[model samples]
Target: MATQPVTTRIVLASRPTGKPVAANFRLEQETVRDIGEGEVLLQILYLSLDPYMRGRMDDAKSYAKSVEIDGVMEGGTVARVVGSRNAAFKPGDIVLSHSGWQSYAISDGSALRKLDPDAAPITTALGILGMTGFTAYAGLRNIGKPKAGETLVVAAASGAVGSAVGQIARIFGARVVGIAGGAEKCDYASREFGFDAVIDHRSSDFASRLEAACPNGIDVYFENVGGHVWNAVFPLLNDFARVPVCGLIAHYNEEPSISEGHNQLPTVMRGILRRSLTIRGFIQREFVDQRPDFYREAAQWIAEGRLKYREDIVDGLENAPEAFMGLLEGKNFGKLIVRIAQ
Candidate 1:
């Protein structure tokens, strides 16, 4: 009998209380089972680290189940099939699979989508050409309903999702204003993603700056970071404005705080009533019907130079924990992905 292959992987060591620390995750080696009928053996190449993963780390009830203790951490991965018992895939075939934070996985071919290296870089499967991009497309088209000449605002503007949101809104003939931390990200959002204006949310005068940037007020606001950024966009929301609530990264790791005027709930409700705002919260899977359309159009935009995507790649799977900690602090410049294999 031959020895089974060993795969290196990371798993949840403990549920985090506040911000996650390295102690929350454990790196270990496990045996890879021999290929079973209809299964493919994959070597993970890239693993996406997203803000929503933070929520999954907790044992709280959410749209998705929490990662069990000592279980593999959940995420999307781009991988290459190393061995296969399925006719749909072959050795050396690349694929997009949700194999989580691991070096290898045995997939049953049901949840795997083959990727063509010729189409675009494989890393894009974990980012721009995949779920994040679909998130931006679906949120804007379905819930936001951007209109020509309307001012559309997006927080976390330099991210994979937010950048796409800004560009797509602009393509819809809407004026786009982006809010991001620091001057560098603001410049990139304005210059690279075609945002009409960009505001630095880190500034002491962030609210005032946001007000100044959106002279016509915000007609469509993409809410991804729901702390002070939402506070600034609140009062500036135009009558009948549409808001699509995406992942609130800012509040993901911390408990929601109560502040001035009993915090933002009263203000949010007031704006909703006074302006007749339409605020809809969504999980990307709800709009999976539009995936084919998003892929066709987003690819066209990428090829035509109308859309720009960026990635911040961390070199090793061993570094995923550190990189993820930085992600919570807004240290990553673009889509954060961990390179687990060559």
Candidate 2:
């Protein structure tokens, strides 16, 4: 008889008060149950840790439902089918799944997308070739609408989504300026990702540096890190400039309530009114219709050496919480992934 599998998982131990600590999560193991007809068993290979997972930790309402207390922390993963009762799957297939932070998972064919490892590394299924890349493409095509010779700015410029956003905008003929949190990331964004200019958000004179970088004004601003970055970019947005409000990692750890000291609604409203700005917040799923086009074009760009990406991989499932906490602090250099298994 074959040995049965076991799954190790991290669950939310409690809703976080502010920045999530390791105490907020608990790890447990369970014997894997046999798969029923139409179900497949998966051994997770990689787990993606993105900034938006912070919002899911809160009890507050948003675009998606909050993960219930003690539920597995939500995430996207790449896995290998270890066993299968589903007619459409086999024991050796690689797939993309929403398997959360677990070492293994059970899936019905419904939620698994088969992956071609020969075409790209299976890990890319959780990063560049997956939702992260799609988010950048959809936001640019549908909202930012970058035109040739226009200037575009993206915050967190060396990140999974922001890197893709800057590169795609450049491919569309926009002049791309990136804002990153450190000198290292700033240099990588400009040197590796091909941003026309890169600004270090941590610089003392960040606002003035940003203004100097985009002398013609910003035609598009991909909003990822908000707060101070938004403040600097607001005054530079040209009339009718497009702002795609994506993940706001800068404020994710704060208490949900707005503080009286930082209220800038009046100034923001006045700016919007004066400039006729088109600021739109979007969830990537809303642009599902463009996924095929995105996959085709992004793959072509990667093949042509016009687009690039990087990964910051941690070695174990146990380290996810710490790695995630660091991600919010801008400590991650690229797409953050936890390699759960070989």
Candidate 3:
């Protein structure tokens, strides 16, 4: 066999205090390790960039461990098995693996799921048919529980999870109201994702506009970007409303000390007590047992035209840092994926 070339990877240069800068990541090349028994060499094709990644940048304790300094940044990737010492996989087989920000990886077949590229675009293993989509489904189904004719409001409405939330809510016969950062994204949500209405959070009249959109009041609030959106949506929630607290990308870059408006907790408690509302926070892994069912249902929905998805793919491993930074700023219009290899 010919000698394998070195693999290039982006490593964590330093932990960021807030918004991650490009200097916080470094590119390095290292010799590819020889595959051992039951090991497979994977060439990464697509890497997912998500809001949760911001939490992983910090050394602070979270549901998931943070990426240590000088380590390859952790991520989910769709890769092709280039070489395998195991009988379960072949060289050309595509698999979904936690390969991080590297061009290539060696894995022991644990936690690697073989995928069929012909079923859908292989890149989708990182997005719509994968974690992002599952997050939306599990969060909404378990927490939101939107009913027919009920109003479902979601922030970051054009993003991966939010978009799926809106579409799925619609499929379940709910009226979907989407809140996005700008007019363009708002248009995409309303026009493409079939949201009943779209509210531009950037607008001066946002709160009032959101209230106007949800005449029946928000029965389910899919909380993605917390902060002003949360403040606005709080008052508009109907009695017994469910809030699926999935992400807080808006506050991800902020320090813990930044003071905002006065205490609204008393009023929030009053609302919760009177209305019997439910609020739940979740990580997607909590629902992996539902993956088989989720994929079957979601894939059927997508095939039957009841679901739609969008992707924002940035080419090259070198561009991953910039793409990730843009993701935090809501600069990405869809599921953000970095194309690492052909």
* Highest TM-score model number: 2
Note the residue pairs that clash in candidate 1: none
Best by lDDT: 2
| Candidate that beats the other on TM-score, 2 or 3, i.e. the better one | 2
lDDT of 3 by residue, 1-342 (tens): 469857889999998987899889999999897899999999998999998988888999889999989999999999999999999999999999999998999999998999987899988888889999999999988889999999999988888999999999988889999999888998888889888898999999999999899888889999988888998999988888999999999788986654556777898898888888888899888987888999999999999988899999999999999999999999998999999889
Question: Which tens-of-lDDT digit does each residue in 115-177 have in candidate 1?
Answer: 989989999988889999889999999999898999999988998889989999888899999
Candidate 2 residues lying further than 4 Å off, grouped into runs, are: 255-258
- Using all chains and alpha carbons, the TM-scores for the candidates as numbered come to 0.97, 0.98, 0.97
Question: Model 1 misses residue 106 by how many Å?
Answer: 0.7
Q: Where is model 1 poorest over a 10-residue stretch in terms of lDDT?
A: 255-264
Summing lDDT over every window of 10 consecutive residues in candidate 3, give the lowest-scoring window.
255-264
Candidate 1 residues lying further than 4 Å off, grouped into runs, are: 1-3, 255-261
Could you tell me the lDDT of residue 4 within candidate 3? 89
Stretches of candidate 3 off by over 4 Å are 255-261
Q: How many clashing residue pairs appear in each of the predictions shown?
A: 0, 0, 0
